[model samples]
Target: MARPTKFQPSYCDQVIEHMTEGASLTSFAAEIGVARSTINEWMEAHPDFAHSVRIAKAKCAAWWEKRGRELAVAGGGNPALVMFGLKNMGADDWHETQRVEQKTTLEAVDPLSALLTQIAEGGRRITDRA
Candidate 1:
């Protein structure tokens, strides 16, 4: 016989509530006496639960961003943590970095050597500039 599932329908509501309150999946799982993988599997098996979790996580992100902004404005928060939260919450508007790649080639690097050679050969004189 197959084993019974540990998930209960009511857990969907509880998970969403906890998630919106800033609980991460791992922490939430621990709080509810389940493994993180179990929660993940439950989400995969229950589409409605997955959707609810997604919404809750989005709200949680917004909540964290708001908290970060509040701390930044209050003048006593960790600047690094605030920036990290803001950057993650609003990546499109608050990207912390940009990457660029450039390539180039120099073709006439021997000009100075050639000039010295000419001077040595008496083809040009040091006083030519004067």
Candidate 2:
């Protein structure tokens, strides 16, 4: 048998209110006396909860961005730390440059050698054409 759920419809509003202050979903879960995974499960089971969570996420990012902007304009606090926080908290809006690398390998094989090697090595190539 499964345990009873602690989810309530009002939690949707609570999540948005909590995240509006730049709080994380994890923190919200902690405040509500639930694990983070429970939040994910609730979102999956309840569409309204999922929508509320989405809005809450955006609000959280906006809150972080607001702080970052305030610090940038005031020039009173550690700009680097604020930038780091924004990059981490508002990753969708603030992100560092990223580099991606792709590699391709080309191999040449003679058809006859490949066929003969395949026969000799039980359907496997023995050497590459050079």
Candidate 3:
């Protein structure tokens, strides 16, 4: 027998409120006395929970972005640390990117033709030696 799930409809609002305050999903799980994997399971089992999680993620990113903007305007916080946090915590909204282009050509060769060429070269070498 499995243990009863701790999922509740109120958890949807709780997660949104938690993450909107710049708290991580893992921290929310810890706050609710659940494992991170349990949170994932809840999302899979509950559609409302999944939607709330999505909203929570966006709100979390917005919170980080707001903090970054404040630091940039006030010139009081460690800019590098704020940038690192934004890049990591709000990666979808803040991060550096690079673009690369590559070109290549692939030619198909007949295995039998290659083998025959090698044999012909060996025959020429033998004739030259003789």
Candidate 4:
């Protein structure tokens, strides 16, 4: 039989709070005197805890983005770092990517054949005018 888990229900709230506050799992585990691998195991075993962690991660991303904006407004932050952080952390919502799709119909006729046809047509017109 497998040994029982060391997870405590009491730590749920704190874990969620810390995650939303931008505390990584490793740091949070260290702060709570738990192993990082143990936390990951708890998340896998507890569906509710996993859901809470997901929500907290979104909140953490929002917090980071807000901080980036505030720093940019204050003009005291490194522009490159701020942009890189925001672009990576808020990629789905903040990153900009352009997609252009051009569609064309292609025929099996060769380009030289088409050009020669045009020239032949022009020659016929010229001869008629002569």
Candidate 5:
């Protein structure tokens, strides 16, 4: 018969919360009054624990990325509008929708306006003082 381990439910919950909050295994172990090696063993023994954290982190990142995309679209990517969305950011914020209206090659503007616009747009929000 297999021996029952002393892995308590509270301990497991603590581990999961710590990991989801971006703590390292060693840090988590320390936070919960356990040895780093012991926590590592638990992670190895309970593959689900590690998998859950990986999925959670990926989901969080995807959500943030998607939010940026939505904001970009909602602002119509106008420099003023985007800036408004970015500035005074509480539930909403920005700058003068800094993006070019769209991807189009027009002789009225520079031939490579579209390309340069694309490159410039890529520079948006690179420095997040917000």
Candidate 6:
């Protein structure tokens, strides 16, 4: 007679994900209705599994920082936007850059008006006099 093998599931990725979210292996096991032993096995099999989940959860962070810099540069802040938002506003981090940028943009520009301006006129860029 052949012996039965342990069950391994594709959701191992998700199971490891939950565990990385500080979901204790036991709780993660229960959440996915699997055994804690199974989650442990998955983590053991793939070391990058945990790192992947953490990165996935915080995926928006790096992206927003990059775009924040983009918008600041486009809005004429250049490198100074980072400094002004960080040092002057006590931002201390990219997360704060988003909040400050959002607040300023909202207070300063009406979306509909900005849209109309863009639609009414081509992107009229000014040539540098220098």
State how far residue 17 of model 5 sits from its true place (Å): 2.0
TM-score of 5: 0.33
Best prediction by TM-score: 3
lDDT, candidate 3, 36-114, per-residue tens: 9999999999999999999998888888888888997887977887787678768987989999999989898999898
- lDDT of model 1 at position 61: 71
> What's the CA RMSD of model 4 in angstroms?
8.9
- Give one digit per residue, the lDDT tens place, for model 6 in 1-130: 9545354455546644554433344665687676777656656766675555444334323433554567766765456645443342222343332344443444577888886686568655334212
* lDDT (Cα, tens digit) per residue for candidate 1, span 72-109: 67878677875775566545556757689999986876
Q: What's the TM-score of each model vs. the native?
A: 0.65, 0.73, 0.76, 0.58, 0.33, 0.26
* Pick by lDDT: 4 or 5, better one: 4
Which residue pairs collide, candidate 2?
none
Residue-level lDDT tens digits of model 5 in 1-130? 9766545556655655655543455666687677877756666777766565455444434444445677667854345543333342322322245566677776675748765676587765435424
State the lDDT of candidate 2 residue by residue for 1-130, as single tens digits. Answer: 9999999999999999999998889999999999999999999999999999999999988887888888878868777877776787788879988799999998988999868876787754456533
Residue pairs with backbone atoms closer than 3 Å in model 1 (clashes):
none
Q: Estimate the TM-score for candidate 1.
A: 0.65
Clash totals for all candidate models: 0, 0, 0, 0, 20, 0
- Could you tell me the lDDT of residue 74 within candidate 5? 82
Instruction: Report lDDT (Cα) of residue 96, candidate 5.
Output: 42
**Positional deviation of 120 in candidate 2, in angstroms?**
13
Pick by TM-score: 1 or 6, better one: 1
Q: Supply the global lDDT for candidate 6.
A: 0.51
Residue 51 local lDDT, model 4: 75
Candidate 1 structure lDDT: 0.76
